[model samples]
Structures are given as C-alpha cells and as structure tokens.
Target chain A: MNDRLTAAERVAIARHPQRPNISDYISALFTDFFEQRGDRLMGEDASILGGVALYHGRPVTVIGTRKGKDLEENIHCRFGMPNPEGYRKALRLMRQAEKFRRPVITFIDTGGAYPGLEAEERGQGEAIARNLMEMSRLTVPVIALITGEGNSGGALALAVADRVLMLENAVYAILSPEGFASILWKDAGRSSDACELMKLTAADLKALDVIDEIILEPGGGAHLARAITFRQVDEAISRHLAELSKGKQLGRYQKFRRIGTAVPKKEGQ
Target chain B: MNSIFAKRRARLLAMKSLREHYVPVGSAAVCPRCGKESGHPAVAQNLFVCPLCGYHFPVGAYYRLSITLDHGSFRELYPKLAPQDPLSFPGYRKKLEAAQRKTGLNEAAVSAVGTIDGRRCVVGVLDSRFFLGSMSSAVGEKLTLTIEYAWKNRLPLIVFSASGGARMQEGILSLMQMAKTSAALGRFDQRGLLYISVLTDPTTGGVTASFASLGDVILAEPGALIGFAGPRVIQQTIGETLPEGFQRAEFQMEHGFVDAVVPRNEMRDTLSQLLRLHEKGGPS
Candidate 1:
C-alpha cells in the first residue's frame, strides 16, 4: 500500500472495486510539473512541497506538505512539521505566483509547526501570523486543498485561501484531536471523542461553511488508487481556477477578501 | 551591704555589654535618644532596609541573580544589547537611561547561563525596577536569543518574569514581540526542551499572553499579579465586579493558570529541585 496516495486515489478506488495505483492516473491530470525548494533564509524544508506546474494548461503554484512513505523520510521531515523558515518559504512562493498573476494552490497536511526554542528565537509565530495577514491580501486567486490533517496555527498559516476545498476523509480544526483531548480531558486516549466534538471531518466543515467544497474520495480511502485521486484533485483545481480567473482583474481579487461571514445575531420580534 | 550592692551593679554592667555586642545591625544603626547615626550595617544580610528609618534601596540585577543561581556559577550573556528607543516615544529613552543608572543594569532583563543545583540552565530574570520591567525589543530579543542558546546547548531554560507587560513606547512593534517570543518558545517545545517560567510581582498583558504562560511548568511568586487583561478592564467588559484576589497569584493557581505558588525565600530551592527532577529524564 503506497502511503503517498492522494484524495484522488480514494475517489478512483470508490469508482472501481479493484483499485489502481495513484501515479498511473497523474499523467491524465497535470500538464507540466517542476519542483522548487529552499526557503532562501536557512535552507529548504522538504515537508512543504511547492512548484510551478500547469493544471489543465494554466500555470499555477502548487504547494503542499508531504508525509513520507517510510519512517526515515518522515523522521527527516520531522513528520511534516514545518519550521518558521518553511512558512516563509511558502509565502515567498505565494508572492511569486501572485506576481505572475498565477493562481495559488496549497495542500495542507501537517500536525503543526515545529515548536523548538531555536524556532522561537527565529520568530516562528510571527512568521506564521505574517503569512496569514499577507495571504489574506494577496492580489491573486488562492485555493487550498486540505488533503489530510489540518492542525492548528501551522495549517491556518497556509490554509488561508480564496476557496478552501477538503477531501471527504480529511480533517480541519484549530488543534489536533489529541491536543484538544490533552487540554480538555487530560487524556490523549479520548482523541476519538474529541474529534467528534471538534467537528473536524470534511463533511462537518462543509456543513459549517468552513470549507467551500468537499472532494469525494474513493471507498476505503485514497491509498488504494493514487492515479484516480490525482485526477479528481486536478479536475477540482481546474474548475475552481477557471471560475476564479474569469472577470478577475486587479480589483476582482477583493471578492475573495470576505468569503466567510460570521453568523449574525437575530433581534427580538 | 555597700560592697554587695557594688558587686550586683558590676554584674548588671557586664550583662549590658554582652547585649550591646550581639545587637542586630538594624537595631544598632539608629540612636534611640537623638535619632543620630549608630554604627551598624544600613542594609541587612537579606537586603532588608534599615530598621530605624525604614528606607529601601534598589537591589541590582546581579545581587538578585546571585541569590537565585548556584553560588559562583552564573555567567551573564548579551549584556551589551540594551534598549534603544526606536519610536522616540516622549521621555521613554530618558526613562530607560534613568532605570539603567538606578538599577546599574543595561536593560530590564539579565540573561545568564548558570547552574541551579548542578543542573545547567539558562535564566532570564526581569527586574521590575527597570522601566517596570517592560518588555521592549531588546528584552524580547535577549529572551529569544537566550532560549535559542539554551536549545542549541540542550540546557533547561528558566525565566523569572516580573514585568508591567509590553513597552507601550514601542507601540505595535512592542506588541509584535509577544508573537515573536511566543514563537521562540514554541520552537523550544519542538526540541523537547524544558522551559520553566517563574512569574514574580506583576506579569500582565502581552507578556502574560505570550511565553510567560507557555512554560511546561509555570510557577509564580507569592502575591504576584498574573493575568492577560487587568481586572478593571475585565470587570468593565463583563459589567460586574471581580471576586477578591482576582488576577493574583493565588487566584490564578486556583484557576489552574499557575502550577504552584512559591515564596520568594524558597524560590531557589524549588527551582533547583524542579531542574533536578526534570534532568533525571522524565517523559518530555
């Protein structure tokens, strides 16, 4: 079982009882793919993957945190825990994509940002907060795909986009279920209950207006058929980019400025 | 009878001599008759003030550090990076200079590498006498640097926070330090390092919101005031009076914001014990 299989794989497996590999369906999805690395401050953060790629012939900035297939890679990437530099690197790429008037696409999948003293000294929280502020005002279309766990401030730092799409199996919340359980119940074993209460599932997020779209995954999850999952993600990305690009001039970016509105209180009759 | 009276008088005089020799420095400092100077130490061994005049003198950061750290083991770090008023907020620079002159400290905080009960640790102690120990950019930078240094050296970090919160003269930049410092502490946690925060006197506002409250074990000095927003603001917001001891160290301990309340006298021992226990290799 390939661990790198994406949401598209799950969708593909759902459509076909006999699941196929995810890489097999990728050729039909994306047009051009180029990998970019290094944060320009310290060094490259492999946990966050970004590149200039063509999605259905349209140039786009593809950003996502990659979880390794094996234990060694996971350890190297700190289990997808981004550092302050990683967020900065992501912001740098986002700015570049905006400069060229290309749509920014981000994939979220991480526990949280690295919380080490060195990271603190380097101003990790400020970096994350800065990204949130800057991304909110970016003058180009930005789309986010929560392909896996969207945990805490780390994910929110990059997950701020014009349209947020979540896979049916993915989860998004202010904190991890385990973390919430630890804080609220003082027991990590209560994570399943905390998850339910947090309403972190993609379906719940969509229902709460927290996510714009919910991309369906194949039955029994995406790892079963990676290629089909990529196709599904590709289709969703193309459709969103096309819709956002139309009549979207310089001022049009303001439309996404206020996408989510808080529910208003009602006055007594 | 005359000889007997003289012998008794001689014995009384000897007893008086012995009592004068053992009198405390505080009691001997002031003459009871004329309020004139008496030969005694004006400041006691514990840095307590004169018993007669009740005059209090400011203690230097070094003296405080000495009392907190293991004997003869503290090495000060980054003493040169003092505060510079970037905002030019009226009289702020002058206030900083006056504080520096009065306290004989370069800035509000004194960061040092020292051993507490043989366990190596990095400590940053905030002096309330220095501009109310407000956290300006220098204080923030020093704290951040100290934490980073601790992480690099794989040492436990201890900070004694005594602040009036963010330096208002620095404005938004000062507020930004809250985020900066918090992020730095977050990184420390990532490295699985121990960060012990000791809140002393008054630690409020931005400092309380940031790293001050983020310690793995948060201990507070008895009678310290620790809170995010002041009680007055909270009361106004909620349109009700706060309960007694609101925002005080005891109140926070009761509310679970503080781990324990330690007296100033026992702080060193408590901290040393905590360091020893943490160094014994418990789960991170």
Candidate 2:
C-alpha cells in the first residue's frame, strides 16, 4: 500500500476487494461485537472506537482508532486524531472493562491527538496524561496491538497495556518519523532516515524493549491480505490472553505498578 | 629662498604641535575599584564579579549545568531533535538552520541524564544563543521526554531556562507545546518525582507561563529578567512608567515568583544542596 495516502485513501484501499480493513475481518471472526461511545462530558468523539465484544466466547473490550471509510466519515471521525472527549471515552471504557473483569484489548492507529484549538481549550493534554496514569493502575489485563501508525500521545493514551504487540510492518514512536524529520533536519524528505534512527518499526521497537511482541503480517502487509493478517493478530491476542489469564491475580498489580522504575543504584552496593 | 621654505615648514610643524597640546574631553576609562580597563575577564573572575566596576555578568546555562552535575558525568538526550519551520514562515527555516549550525546543537535546549554529586538526575540546559533560546516544538518535545524519562527511571529533573519565549515561526503549535510540556510535568509530579526549575537570564513569554514556573522549587539567577511580558509592553499598556527593576530577579523574589535569587558563583552549591535534600526523601 502507498504510505503517502491520507487516512481517506487508506480507508478506500481497505474497501477494495484486494484489501480489507483488519477491523472488518476481526468483526467477522469474533462471535459478538458491540460499540459504546461518549464520555458524557461534552459530546461523542468518533475518532476512538470502543466497546465490549466476545472473542471466541470470551468477553473482551475492543478499542481502537478508526479513520472512516469515506470523506464524510473521515470528517466525522476527524481522521482518527482524537480529542479530549475521545480520550475520556477510551478511559471510561477501560475503567468499565476493569470493573467487569474483562480483558482490555486496544488496536493502536493514529497520527496523534487532534491539535485543534478547541481540543486544547478542552484540556486534551490533561486527558492523555490522565489516561497514562490511570491505565498504569488498572486491575484487569490489558493488551495493545499497534496495527498501523502509532504516533505521539494519542497512541500512548490507549497503549499503556501489560503487553504491547505490533504488526511486522507497523510503526510506533513518540512521534511520527516525518514529524521527527521535519524537526530534526528542517526537511520532511529525511523521513526515511528518521524512521531508521527513531527505532519506530515493529522490529526496531521490539529490540528497544519498547514493544513486547511483533505479530507476523501476511506477505505484502495487512493491506494485501486482510483475512490472513486478522487471523495472525487474533492468534497472537489469544496466546497473550491465555498467558495473562494464568497470572490475572498473582502480583499482576505490582507488575504494572513497577513498569518504569529504574532509578540508578548508589555506588558500593 | 632656502630661509623662506624653512620658515613655512616650521610654521606648519608648530600648528600641528598646538593641536596635540589640547586635552580630549571624554569620560576617563578607569575602573572604580581597581583602576584598570573594563571588560577584562580576570577582573570579572576576581570578586565573583567584573574586573572594572565589579559588575557581574549573569551565568549562562552551560556553566550552570556543569557546576550542578558531577564532574565528567553528563549524557545528553535528544540531541538530534532540532527545530523546523512547520508553517513555512518566511526566513524562519533559515534562521533555525543557522542557529543549529552556529551552536552545533539540534535545538535551543540541551537535555541530558547525569549524576549530581553521585546521585542520578535528569538535567536540561537552555542556551540563550539560539534565537534567545526560544521554546519551539523540539525544545518542548525534549523537555516532555526528559520529564517522562525521569518519571520512568525515578530520577529528579533539573532544567535551566533562558528563553525569550515561544518560537513564533511555529505559530499556535508553539503555544500548544506549553500545555503538552506542562502535562508531561504533571505526570512526573503525580509519580512523586522532583522537578527543579532554574530560571536564568531573560526567562520570559510562554515558557514562563508553563513548565518553567511549574517546578517544585523555582530558582532564578541574580538580576535575571523573569516575566510573562516585556517591561516595555506592560509600561505601554498601562500608560505609565513602570517601577525601576520591575520583573527583575530581585523584584520577582519580592513578589514571591522566585524562591531565591542565588548569585552565579553560588548557584551550583545551592542546586546540589537542594538535590541532596530532595533525593533523601524522594519517591523510590
């Protein structure tokens, strides 16, 4: 698939017979899929897609960013760049999943949060930060799969999972490679080099200890064979869920609490 | 004929001598304290002050960071994330590129993780050489990442701020970084990590309104300009002459905006003391 396409173009490509969206295939594979929206604060945000569903008869919360299938839909979804409301919605769903003891699964895909003035006025940064803090303490097992471009805080807002998985071709970073290139070189043309240096590719992230696993994508990427890609992702999720279910209660809380504690030790230890 | 030529030459020579005899009327170039020329480095170094009138130059960020960190121990972070012209603003890219080339740095700020007297701390120093060390996207991102890194590694954060304000070339994005950076700091605070902000010369604009002022302990260099707006702007808006030294370090200290105005020579010791105090009871 062409990487330069806007979210609309990618959605169109997914609609083609040669390429289907991962969400479409997964919905078909799962026995039940239900979507819930809004944080009851301001209004509903279409950028984040969330709700509970049954994966092979096991209840799970499925959340991901959606770019929409058409221009109008993209406009409604804001090209999947969420706002404060969208993050709040995701948090609400995650908290609900914890309450119900359902495994929370999130598919990461976004260029970052909406940087619009309204978003800022409504405290988008606070919402994203709050999510990071809250997710670190949530009691249920959480899994995140980077299905596409996971860029900036928007991706991180929904990506504080116990185990973070990424597709072979996906990219995940603190910021997009193009964004990094623009900042570092004052030229967007250096995006390829930025990608290499940022350690954003799934393989790179796995090596950096930034990601836990890399699910194999079908030859030519998920855009080429959606069914195969979906099956691979489903299997990966299942395996992780099974392993996580075993330690669901024992030291799980402490494991999440101790995620980033690496203070240097004093000398002469 | 020889006598006449000699007479003319003598007259000309006498006129030139007359002009040299007159004393030039200008201020004498004498040091009040030491009776030496001003602008000499030795004079400035002697009294923790200037060689001439004993006036002290404000310490820059590099010197501050070095004094605060343990000798020979500082590892810089995000040195490659420089500023860019995101809006295609005229002359902005050229200015940023030139600043980077001149400073041999990617951005206005230098972020690093180093040991402060054998205790690990995340340190950032903002050089005022690059566009007055403005806060652009790169600076903001570096700061945010530094805070997050500190939070992740359970390290304290210390930043020396010397800025003219936000990078105007980035438009509203620059303003947005204020919130983004503050949010990151908020996360760090929630994690019970200590963040100490050292405000240096000319810390102003959006930076003062955000992370620079949000530190758990706000320290400023003696005689630094620390405010949200320029004195001239405030004076013009108020239609009156502002108070002398308004917004200066002393004034800000009086107004309770700054915790202390430590002299340049004593800043290192003060910061080290603060770090040791915080490290003793800081979050594990």
The models' CA-based lDDT, in order, is: 0.65, 0.67
Give the TM-score of chain A in candidate 2.
0.86
Colliding residue pairs in candidate 2: B43-B51, B44-B51
Q: Cα deviation of B96 in candidate 2 (Å)?
A: 18
TM-score of each: 0.46, 0.53
| Clash numbers, per candidate | 20, 2
Q: How close is candidate 1 at the interface, in terms of C-alpha RMSD after superposing the true interface residues?
A: 18.9
Best by lDDT: 2
Worst-scoring 10-residue span by lDDT in model 2 chain B = B16-25
Q: What is each model's TM-score for chain A?
A: 0.83, 0.86
| Residue A18 Cα positional deviation in candidate 1, in Å, after optimal superposition | 16
